[model samples]
Target: MCPPEHFEVSYSINPWMEPDKPTDAPLALVQWDRLRARLVSLGHRVDVVPPRPGLPDMVFAANAATVIDGRVLAARYRHPQRSGEEPAYQAWFAEHGYPVRQAGFVNEGEGDMLPTGARILAGTGFRTDHRAHAEAADHFGLPVVTLHLVDPYFYHLDTALAVLDHEEIMYYPGAFSPDSQALLRELYPDAILADEADAAVFGLNAISDGEHVLLPQSAVHLTESLRAAGFTPIAVDLSELLKAGGAAKCCALELRESLPSTERRREPS
Candidate 1:
């Protein structure tokens, strides 16, 4: 995780960003610290990459890269505002002994690529291009299930859905194209459908450690629903960070060892 030492929404790229809106930097830092503490408390190891000036959104480390097995496919952001972040993230991976691979396509890393044990759910239409999914399939040797996001509010797949292991998923269907929604139903019929109110507040962006779920404090209903499903919910107030279009899950990067070598899933010709 990169510290929010220099975080500010100086420019607008998505519907959630507002350059005129004021952000509470101090509050953002405190919230980040609490998130870090919560992750550690839940028995997860935390890593830090020093924050750099002019790269405020670096705090959203999930956009840094997509790591499958030990190979790091660094992000090539669509916006110039975030493109500078690619080299820094790549450097961090190299420093930590992970092999960094150059991505030949435009992809926003984990922001649009979510691994669901059985497959990688890749999102396109906003931040990531469909071509990136093909590149990822070749690089990681995992089946890439592509979904197109239609709602501009849910620019990234991670913003619209959260993969809770391979069996269960919670998502906002309205954020997806009708075809994608149908595909989702075909893939996971019993997936938890997030309500509009909670989804608007980025509730579906919550992080689940299998047993414990870290979500936005405002998602009261989602919390209860999670409990009913036998998962403990930990509400965290990342309101300040929300101003810049990220919350609990968006700020943290999930690191993994190299995926076991496997055959590639179906790719578009």
Candidate 2:
């Protein structure tokens, strides 16, 4: 049963994160409560956990992992300090009624997974690795498309690319590899391009609902594009999160499941 492929998606709370280089920029506790409230209001069932001390950035706990089918595939984080998250994640999934499975492969939670349609794209090379790509494809029946990580701090795939609607994926090409481009083209022929600089300004990491895309106020052209495509765009100020390298989008929300999973369909990564 463990080897057999199965399931879709679910969401969870992020612990918190701290920057390694910056000593002055503190991780705020007040923002976390507000973040939790916002997500819970969106009708998500949130399960919060306290982060262990000293690991200020530990709250952005990749150990929490993603669930597809009935299985909890443990995420393999690139940072050594994050490796300890797996044991807890595996146990959490099993206890929560999900079939638990360990992935020897390394991956970043948000960065590695692009689960849509029947295809699931897994990002590697920066916060994740090749082992992750192979394991995800083989174990989960999802074709793992590898995305190359470019730029130093754009450590996760979510940093440069995001899938908005079934047919739309937002990308920052400067960070893409040749293989990544070809793979994306095969899956999405009509992908709208958002420049790397623009994407870095919170253009690409924007999240989506069936009729709306929540974007940063700064993305004028992209916002217009969304409206033209019949989407109501909501803007939120993610200045505090963005200052810490997160966007208005990535800082809080998790794409847990598509209500009508069959209608939206899944795309390969």
Candidate 3:
């Protein structure tokens, strides 16, 4: 995990960012510490990637890459603001001895790609280019389920949808195109739908370890729904980080797959 020591809105690219808005640096550090402590306390190991001075968005590590079966498909960001982050993350993976494959197409790593057990769910239409989907398919040898995101607020697939275990999926329909929404309905008929109020707070941008779900504290409706669905929902207040357009799941989590036993224990927590 990286600290938000240099996090600030120097420029605006998405709806959540504004050049005039200032981030609470101290509070962001405290919040990040709490998240790390919470994850560690939950029997998960935590690792640190030293934060760089100018790359403020390094705290949101999920945007770094999409790793599966020990192969790293490093990100190629669309926006120039985040383009500088690619090398740092790629270097991290390479130093750890992972095979890092440089991506030719534009993609934002886990921000647009998520492996939902059976198939890979990929998002397009905003930050990630559609050609990246084909690249992902070729790289991973997995069938890619392309879901087009329509709303500017839900810029990434991770923001619009949350994979609950292998079969169950939760998402906000309004963020997706009509055909994508219909595709989702057909794909996961028993999927949980989040209302606009909950979705607005990024309720669907949650992380789960099969049973326990760590979500935004303000998303009470989603918390209760998760409880009813037999999943444990842990509320974490990441409001300070949210000011920069992300929350607990987006900032702290990086999902990888099929690592050697040693690297698996050290890399993912």
Candidate 4:
């Protein structure tokens, strides 16, 4: 995760960003620090990337790259404002001893590509290009399932859907195209569906450690649904970061390593 030291709504890249509105940079940092603390308390190791000037969106580190089996597929951002973030992320990954592969197409790293236990759930019709799916498939050596996002509010797949476990997920179906929604239903018949209220608060932008789910505190109904599904939900306040179109999942990037017993494990908490 990258610190929100320089984070601000200086430019509008997504629907959530409002450049005219007031943004509390100090409060954003406090909230981000709390989030990192919460994740560490849950037995997760948090890594920090130094924040660079003129790259406010760098705080949303999940958009930097997609790491699976120790291979890093560095991002090629669609928006010029975020384009500067790619090199910093690539340098960090390379310095950390991870093999970094630059993407041939426009792909927003983990923002558009999400890994399930069996295959990759890739998002398009927004920041990521449709052709990037094949690139991700070849790079990770895994099947890629493409899902189209219809709602501008849920531009990234992580904003509308979150992997709860190896085979389970929770999502807001309205954010996806009808065909994509049908595909999701076919793939996860028992998936938890979130209402518009919860989804409006970016409730689907969550991270799970198989048992514990960390998400926004304002998603009241989604919180109950998680409990009903026998998962522990840890509510956190990231209201300040919400102004910049990010919360728990957006600030954190999961670096997945292949294990001897399994090809790939689910994303970390």
Candidate 5:
């Protein structure tokens, strides 16, 4: 039988986080509702899990690890405190039946898993480490482009680079090593350079659903350019989420499936 088409996703209403961090309740609620509506409009079956208690900051939804081919690799967050998140995800995965795998040491979440076609440009430094990249390549059967990050602000790889389409990417030059930059230039000479200001808004955390791109309402020019390129640009507002360092593009998820059986799942690897 074909696996279920519906996806199961979890969220943490309470996070072991800085209580002082400001939260815009109305804005966040609006953003979450829009995401649900967009997914439904695209014909995706979404399963929502209330955020685990005490993981309130889980609203910065990208902390979950990346997954591919049923191998649910857990994330090792950069913030020492955030590392505590993995065990919870692991437990959640076990209960949910997603396979268990872990990123290499000193790593963090899926924000570092930048997919370029079949190639994995795994980031090393604040969020993810080299060992995780190597192991990830082994499990997923893909080549890894190891990027040694130098800046803390650009801790997550997704913050600096993202795949726009199958053959196109959006990247910021300063965030890349010279060799990676050269390689990117060689591969997609026509790829766009995402605006630094916009990337700051975490707009680069765009969703490329194998075709159209789900972008941010704040990125007007880039959104127009994306539409010009034939992508059905879907803009969502995420300002309240951004107050805690999250943007609309980064709030949702990308669910991968196991091959052959090919059923979609919620938990990450």
Candidate 6:
């Protein structure tokens, strides 16, 4: 995750960004630090990427790349405001010894592509191009299920839907198109459905390590639902980052790769 040292709402990229409104940069950093601490406390190793000037949105590190099985498919941003972040992320991945491939089409990394155990759930209609889905499929050798987004508020798929595990998920049905919603139901019949109130607070922008689900504290109903589903819900305050259309999932990117059994069993402090 990248620090929110340069985070600000100086320009409007999404519906949530209001440039005219006041934003607390120091508070954003504090909230981001707390989030990193929480992840570490949960036995997860947190990696930091140095923040660069003139790239405020770099704090949303999840949009930097999509890593699957040690291969990196770097993001090709649709908006020019975020384009500069691509090189930094690509360089980071390359320097870290991950094979990085530049995207041939406009794709916002994890923002539009969500990898599951079997296939990739890709979103289009706002930031990501539908053609990028095929590129991702060919690159990862996994089937890509295209889902169309209809709501401007939920521009990225991560904002409306989150993968719970290999076979489970939770989402806001209203954010997707009718066909997409139907397809989601057909695929994940037992998925948790969030109400409009919870969704409005970006409740679906969560991270679940199969057992623990971390999300925003304002999503009261989602917390109860998560507990009912036998999952531990860790509520965190990310209201400062929410002003820029992000939360926990936005700031963190999962780097999926094969590891030795011994290394995998080692808990991180």
Q: List the residue pairs that clash in candidate 6.
A: none
Candidate 4 C-alpha lDDT tens digits along 120-212: 899999899999999999999999999999999999999999988787899999999999999999999999999999999999999888788
Give the Cα error of residue 81 in candidate 2, in Å.
2.6
Q: Best-fitting candidate, measured by TM-score? A: 4
Q: Write the per-residue lDDT of candidate 6 for residues 1-269, one digit (tens) a residue.
A: 99999989999989999999999989999999999998999999998999999999999999998999999999999999999999998888888999999999999999989988778999999999999999999999989999999999999999999987776789999999999999999999989999999999989999888778899999999998888887889998899999999988999999989312221121212
* Residue pairs that clash (backbone atoms under 3 angstroms), model 4: none
Q: In candidate 3, which residue ranges exceed 4 Å CA deviation?
A: 259-269
Q: What is the C-alpha lDDT of each candidate?
A: 0.87, 0.56, 0.83, 0.91, 0.62, 0.91
lDDT of 3 by residue, 163-191 (tens): 87765779999999999999999999978
Question: How would you order the candidates by TM-score, starting with the best?
Answer: 4, 6, 1, 3, 5, 2
Ranking by lDDT: 4, 6, 1, 3, 5, 2
**Residue 15 C-alpha lDDT in model 6:** 96
Better of 1 and 4 by lDDT: 4
Please, what's the RMSD in Å of model 5? Answer: 7.6
- Name the candidate, 4 or 5, with the larger TM-score value: 4
Query: What digit string (tens of lDDT, one per residue) describes model 2 on residues 87-179?
Result: 654565566676655667676665557666556766766667777778777767766667776565556677667767654676766667787
Clashes (backbone N, CA, C under 3 Å), per candidate, total 4, 17, 0, 0, 16, 0
Question: Tens digits of per-residue lDDT for model 5 on 108-176?
Answer: 555777655557778776657688887777877978778766555566677677676555677676777
**Which pairs clash (backbone N, Cα, C closer than 3 Å) in model 1?**
69-257, 69-258, 69-259, 70-258
Best of the two (2, 5) by lDDT: 5
* lDDT (C-alpha) at residue 162 in model 1: 93
